[model samples]
Target chain A: MALPLNYSFRNALVRWRSTIATVLGIALVVFVFVLLQSLAAGIEKSSSNTGDPRNIMVVRKGSTAESASLISRQTLTEIRYFEEIARNENGEPIISADVLVLASLPRRDNSGEANVLLRGVTARGMELRPQVKLAAGRWFEAGKREIVVSAKLAKRFANFGIGQSFKTGSATFTVVGWLDGGGSAFDSECWLDADECRSTFERDMYSSFLIRPTDEAAGEKLITRIEADRRFKLKAEKEVEYYRKQTMTAAPIKWLGGFLAVMMSVGAVFAAMNTMYAAVGARTREIGTLRVLGFRRRAVVAALLLEGGLLALVGGVLGCAIAFYWNGYTTATMGMETFSEIVFEFRVTPKLVLEGLAFAVIVGLIGTLFPAIRAARLPVISALKSI
Target chain B: MSANIVTIRNLSKIYQQGDINVTALDNISLDIASGEFLALMGPSGSGKSTLLHIIAGIDRPTNGECRVQDIDVAKLNESQLADWRNQNVGFVFQTFNLIPVLTAYENVELPLLLTRMNRAERRKQVEIALEIVGLADRAKHLPKQLSGGQEQRVAIARALVTDPALVVADEPTGNLDSHSAQEVLGVLRTLSRDAGKTVIMVTHDPKAAAFGSRQIHLEKGELSK
Candidate 1:
């Protein structure tokens, strides 16, 4: 005979202490799973939302990132006059010859050193990226040892506030302003004049060029033209596409997250198993009574499994709630591609919460399987004899 | 006289207790008529419970066969035996054995869940069973909430709820006080005499055995005719 479902539910409630332990253990594991997935999602969104689709990014051939690409002054001049390039209101091609470098700086909260991205942009740089907005003070003057820090970076590092000066190598740069990048990847960088950066760093070449095309056909033709030129071996991809590729930097984080979840799940599964085993032991006489009353072994197994599933379902919802309530909380971590600190907020999407709930159910199934089988296989005579 | 409802042929049960074989039942042959209340009385290790379990289709005999109402209880497989017991044999335990979590009405409705009866029909049968035990007003009370006499009456209602051909009870009043014990015995007496249900009860108390129509004794795994 099939056992009624209320039997299992009442049994679980009657033995609330053990049920609470198993539920809390599963909840902790699910909480960790949700947060880790959100971390990976946050990193991916930061990179993918970086650049505009209308602009073309020029980097040296085989260069994986802008910091590794080097464009000479002659090469930058040659590429500025292309017919496919869009002209600004002043009839000048909309281009930004930028220099990229990494500087070690001390954190405000901790004295330990961390890498900060130092970028030097040309005159048209601010116009090229409309997402960056000057939040305070004013833009740095040309040919001066002055820099503009991102508001996020200014909050994270020491001596990067407006009007503060920090020394790197043989040069001292004053932070004259803070610009907000609207959660884009540029929020990790400090910007200054390209010429001053080259002179101070003793480099004769720019890192990369950011250019806007007139239209879709122009964008396509510009990429073909840039790659076809024999004078400079370079690759041109849409700025949006280039930033999307930067998400590969989050691969290790995803792997580490998965590895940690698997390790913790083992403990969660064991905790659930232990709880079920104790329940079976305590209910041996009850099982025998049911068997004597003509209830089948399959019915007993189903009842026990239902109890475990109910516990895990409740735990899963609790865990998802814990993760969702903390959404939009900002945190910073080292960027894999740029080797600099990138600030992002926790993004606990509905899809990730659903995945967490599904994970809890699977763990519940795994934990209940062996114990249910053991309960079903118990001998009617022996179970009856148990006190 | 009522016709024979249970027929046994040289039933024996042997158990292996870690290299030592213990004979729980030895060459027992008996017949129990329908509407008869038969008591099997024996000391500890006397095989009375073993014989009862075999007749209840819960245990297999090492040798010989047992048949209840034309179904060979010994030949049926585990699942088939379980189904047979559900339709034919109701059980009464010494401890009342009511699930503590279930109310008295729910406990009575348990055996009927095996059948294809709908909810309304189940409720009707459970109400009637509880009425027979005079606990109709206590149907919603959990086992722990009921007194010893009330608990044993609820167990009797559960046994009779399915209207089975036979009720096998092992020491049904062993844990009850004298007053509650008499009440449980009176319920079993009414089931056999008025309702014509065959009842096989195993107990060591002769006073409890006096309530039955006939008595059988078992000694050292053998029956005393």
Candidate 2:
């Protein structure tokens, strides 16, 4: 018969000092593991939350991101009037050819400088993204050299307040408003008039086209038509799909999180193993007594494993709780696709918490395996003789 | 006379102490009757404890047969031996090896936990066992909170809780003072006399041996003439 759970639990309490040490060791490892993973999760969430399913994005065929793609005005004109494209109440086709540029700006905290994305779009482009809403002041007027900064970006970058000016490529532009991107990729960029941006940067081509289709079937048809046309040399996909592909930026962070967790868990395993070994050594006589009382070798092993698992579970919970404090906390990292700072909130999701707990339990079980077997294998006669 | 509860024939246990074959028990033959308080007295390394462990199925003999309650313990595999011991044997130790974290009540309740009895039945048996040792009031006290004598009595209660046919105690009074030793010895005597338990105890103390109904001595791994 198996020993009662209370036996393992009380033994842990009786050896509180070592129990706490092992628990904290595992806790610190799980904390680092969860925190690092949450960073990757946050970046993935930021990208995947962007774009609407009904809208389509057109970029140069070989380019991986809008910032790297170039489509000329002629190509935009050739595709803008397709019957599949949706039109506004005023009977104008809801399509926008946009330009993307990068400018290095100083941080409000004076923490060196980071690359910020500048997205120049027309009034039609603003209508295509209903998720981005003006949070303060008025939208920029056409050809005024005025810009609307993302509410999130305004909090981080210098000279982003209303009426404040920042210099980029010998041209000074004033911030006219703050727009909230609803935690989407657009939160990482500043917006101005597309024509003004092309003239100011001396660019002859638009970076990408954002188009809204009349319906899902029409969007699919438009995507298929653009991909099949050999003349334009352009790729078209649902806007949501395009943003989802940008999650590749989180791959390196995911790898780093996994690597750090694996490394720290090795140390945690040894620490737990040491604690269990010491417990077995200290309770040699007790083990023998239980054997003589007719507890089998398996029972002893199971009891010890239960104790180890419980100990690690507590550590897991503590670690998850500690990491939860970072949830919704805003942070910035360089976006691999745009080569600019992408601000996102740390997200400690429920699934991540479960994974952390499972990791801790596995570590506990592995650490206790050999020590528990050793305890069980001890000769009852000799164990009773131990002082 | 009551039926024999434990039978040993030509039992020998040899240890390989790094190539030296040291004999712990050598061709010993003995029979212990039910309800008998039998004490095996010897000095250190005299093999009295080894014999007790063999009879209790905690250790297997190198040769020959040890049958307790008609089951040949030495012939049984490890798992069967454990089940046999759980069903038919209880044990006591000189150190009063009550789990320190558990209270006296929980300590006594341990052996019963192996049985199929429900909580109420187990509680009833545990209470009776503690009452037999006159420590029912001290049932809630932890081992560290009890006197050495009280702890040994609690161990005795634990031994009797499962109502096993045989109870083997190895140096049950080795760590107790004279007064506490008497109290523990008294409890064992009561178990044999009133409860009809077959108790096999190993001790070097003449006074402790005197408390048993019968006594045997061993020397150099052999029974003394």
Candidate 1: TM of chain A? 0.94
- Which stretch of 10 consecutive residues in model 1 chain B shows the poorest summed lDDT? B77-86
DockQ per candidate, 2 decimals: 0.71, 0.78
Candidate 2: which pairs clash?
A: none
Each model's lDDT: 0.89, 0.91
Off by over 4 Å in 1: none
Best by TM-score: 2
Q: After superposition, how far is residue A258 of candidate 1 from its true place, in Å?
A: 1.4
User: Given candidate 1, what's the lDDT at residue B134?
Assistant: 95
Error of 2 at A20 (Å): 1.4
